[model samples]
Target chain A: MSNTDLEDDLRGTFDRAAASVPMATDLTGRATTDARRAQRRTWMISAAAAVAVASIAAATFGLSGGRSTPVQLPVAGGNAPASTSAVETEPSVETVSGTWRPVQMAGLKALSAERPEDPVLVFRPDGTWTGSDGCNGLQGTYNIGQRGEFTAKAGMQRLIGCDNVPHTGVLQSAKRIAVDASTLEFYGADGRELARYARAR
Target chain B: MEFEEYVSARGQDLVRLGFTVSGDYQRAEDLAQIALMQAFRSWRKVRKADDPHLYVRRILVNAYLSMTRRRSFTESPSAEIDPPHPVPDPATDIVNSDDLWRALAELSARERVVLVLRYYQDLDDRTIADMLGIKPSSVRSTASRALATLRKARQSHHVS
Candidate 1:
């Protein structure tokens, strides 16, 4: 009947509800294991990215009209090498604008379609993107700056329940993209590689 | 304190809060895990804050809100329909408590959240607003509407 009565009733009801539900089991154990796995994934990604970049640089150096000196490529936590006359390559609009298939996602090294369908992503030149997480349909808009800075905003998505569906978490976290002739790599805001995709055949 | 120690101390409370907000134990556990994982990822930064527990609370609330919003966009229309309300006997305190629980569940997610944060967590409208990313006035209005709904539900139970 009164405000105090209402507040008391609410508190009583909530307290009862809270008491009825049991505390989550193994929450700490699960959380710690997940955290450690995530940490390992980050380290692996960093190492893979460094190797990928080195290989790309070495290939580019060999194709640079046979330059006499090899320009040292960047390594993880290593000092910057001396600059050379060979022009550094960057992914252009043509390289980035197309459909891609996930080679790796969600911190997993390989994503095999458990079902008949595989996840696909379409990054349109008009700054819009659409994809299937192998089950649910997802659409979003994206932006690409002059220096390969990238960002994506998710739009409508279906709520179909399916297992092993590739998550968009990595794409959402991507801050930059690097595209070579066949593969594209997405880097997080912290400059760590998040996911890698290959051109769809 | 270390992250594992913090989890041992306050993890149950976070999960309980999640259950209160979501009204589903499985989802509550999922929400709590997501928040805890996020907190674990940034434990260093979170621990340095004035109240690291508060930071985790904010994350849990935000995650619950985000999940609800996404569900709203894609949830089937048939799922939103509530069952017919049953008349409660004012003579029975047990019946009255059941009515109260029903009334609480009838409230919208945002309304329930406002009440849960206000009554359950004893947070002010300003703090709730900050957590929900809404204006303080909006928080007040939401709470006002929620309380009004609860009162009306109680009054109807007594009338019948």
Candidate 2:
């Protein structure tokens, strides 16, 4: 069909489909509990939100627990392709060198439970990080600079959303252990350190 | 605004919108009622927002998206409609109310939402996107695609 024809058809279709479905009985009455008992005065928007809000509230319970922790909404981040980067001999920390350990940080376990779909990150030496956050599973660059401490300033981070500050307590604890103690400690989100030890000799 | 008066004026329009979006009157009514309650609870703050109506719309839109969780959100048929006016010319009618309901049913939940917001509520892309917590671009794209589907449905109805 021609463009003009398509446009006309589109408008026609919108009007018919939109208008035909029966409007809710006493919609403003039903949609909202809002009503003014005052004496006669005109011009008010009644039960305005009812027809407009649908399924969003039905699933509110699922979101309530998740809201306790900042769960990143999904954006389709994925695992990095296996390459020389995956299985190469580089002095830098890129490939997974050490054995995997339980990320005893309950901050994430708590966060992940809320949004199992969000992505998580585990930093590696050779400029990369990986893991499934609450939303997506992903691995990306880890630029750690020793001399400039730019990477220190830039910092390691996972991308779950927060109002402002997030993972504030845990990351600080983890960084202090990484730098001063030359040690690693596993901690639950409750702030109980689960395990502690010096770097593997 | 006093809650009672508010209900009388905008109640019908809200119901129309709910029916338009969900294609089920019962579900629409429940949704509308819940939206109103929530609005009432927050009306003090809502009244202060840049467009209080827009704020309420956001709440309603959010409520609709969360419908699956509500025990009352069933897929029953529409409640009967006694049109405000008597029947008019048939040729001009083209598709009757029942025909329109079926077409709306065929749309995905998201499509139904976009179309309802676009025409029924008379909201623009920016407003719709804000309501859905999606980008404005997604609103435009969804509306265009949904309208295309509606047109196809209408055409098929005509041909048949």
- Stretches of model 1 off by over 4 angstroms after superposition: A38-201, B72-94
lDDT of 1: 0.70
TM-score for the first chain of model 1?
0.53
Candidate 1, residue A52: Cα displacement in angstroms equals 7.9
Instruction: Report i-RMS for every model.
Output: 3.0, 4.6
Please report the candidate that would top lDDT against the real structure: 1
DockQ of each: 0.39, 0.21
lDDT of 2 by residue, A1-201 (tens): 444554454345446544555544554544343433210111111112211121222234245543333222111122421111123222223222232323333322333244544323355543344544344444433232221111111224456553212222322222112211133332222223322323222
B88-160: candidate 2 lDDT, tens digit per residue: 5654434354455566677767777876787656788888887887899998888777667766776787798
Model 2, runs deviating above 4 Å:
A1-201, B69-74, B78-89, B96-100, B158-160
| Residue B57 CA displacement from its true place in model 2, Å | 2.2
